[model samples]
Target: MLSAGPTPKVPLDSWEFVITTETGAEYRWSWSELMALPQETPRVDIHCVTRWSKLGTTWQGVSLDTLLDGIDTDAAYVLAHSYGGYTTNLPLDDLRGGRAWVAHTFEGGDLPAEHGGPARLLVPHLYFWKSAKWVRGLRLLSADQPGFWETAGYHDYGDPWREQRYQGD
Candidate 1:
């Protein structure tokens, strides 16, 4: 797990998202697009691979449970589209388990962009990389897939409680 350091603050009004693939493929997303997604409020603990664990982060944004609604995702895994085309993939079930969220606000305030502002996936159970920043969209896959650091041998689940950081798990 790597720490990008204390996240810089960016107002939600200034936050922007561009969903892209490893090959520079992209789809621009507007704040309104996110606002349109069904919203939910949840209590979460964020574990950064950098080792900063922020407990009880109250967030507001689209719930993975709702964002994926009606989408026929046959893939067994999911890849999160991110800035710089940096990406990470995880088990689809983990995403759909009703614990994931596209969080925009933290502690009732807008999340800073450095913290993956506008919106970022909050997978509290996994190491931070599994929780990609500047999240744009989700890519479904049929097998265990790796992304960015995962290709560099990072763990798949990244569960902090169990210390799933590298591939030896």
Candidate 2:
């Protein structure tokens, strides 16, 4: 089990995942409600920034693009905030076009909390760290602001193929 911080105990019954933008826009998705939304099962190979890779894993959830449907935004980046103060940044392009998901299930079962149960961002193209665990919200920004790990010297845009693990790598 790899963890960058303590696992947050998210209350499944009372939690609501949210997506927001700078211009006073917000969408609240109750756990059950979001799960009822259109879901996709994508086979993703996750590469961790810590030098490990899990290949061809399956996940089921709502695609980021689908969640953003009908929402107009000119922002170029997003700060994905989680229930436990964890945050990661992704370019607007990264979260669109089926590149990411707000996943709630893994391997044909409800996602275990240890693996970010209720909802987590799944961005397969980038290092797993960019797939923020226990994700609760996404705040759009016009500027590319660094997230938690990025601010702590990890690469802002973690591309696994390029092995962009740390700042200045």
Residue-level lDDT of model 1, residues 1-169, one tens digit each, is 3433444444556546543333444544467777886788888887877678988878887777776665554667777866546679888889776788888887889877767776788887887788777676776667777888888988877889888888897
lDDT of every model, 2 decimals: 0.73, 0.89
- Top TM-score prediction, candidate number: 2
RMSD (Cα, Å) for all candidates, in order, is: 4.0, 1.0
Off by over 4 Å in 2: none
Among these predictions, the greatest lDDT belongs to: 2
Write out the backbone clash pairs for model 2. none
**TM-score, every prediction:** 0.80, 0.96
Candidate 1, superposed: residue stretches over 4 Å from native: 1-29
lDDT, candidate 2, residue 91? 94
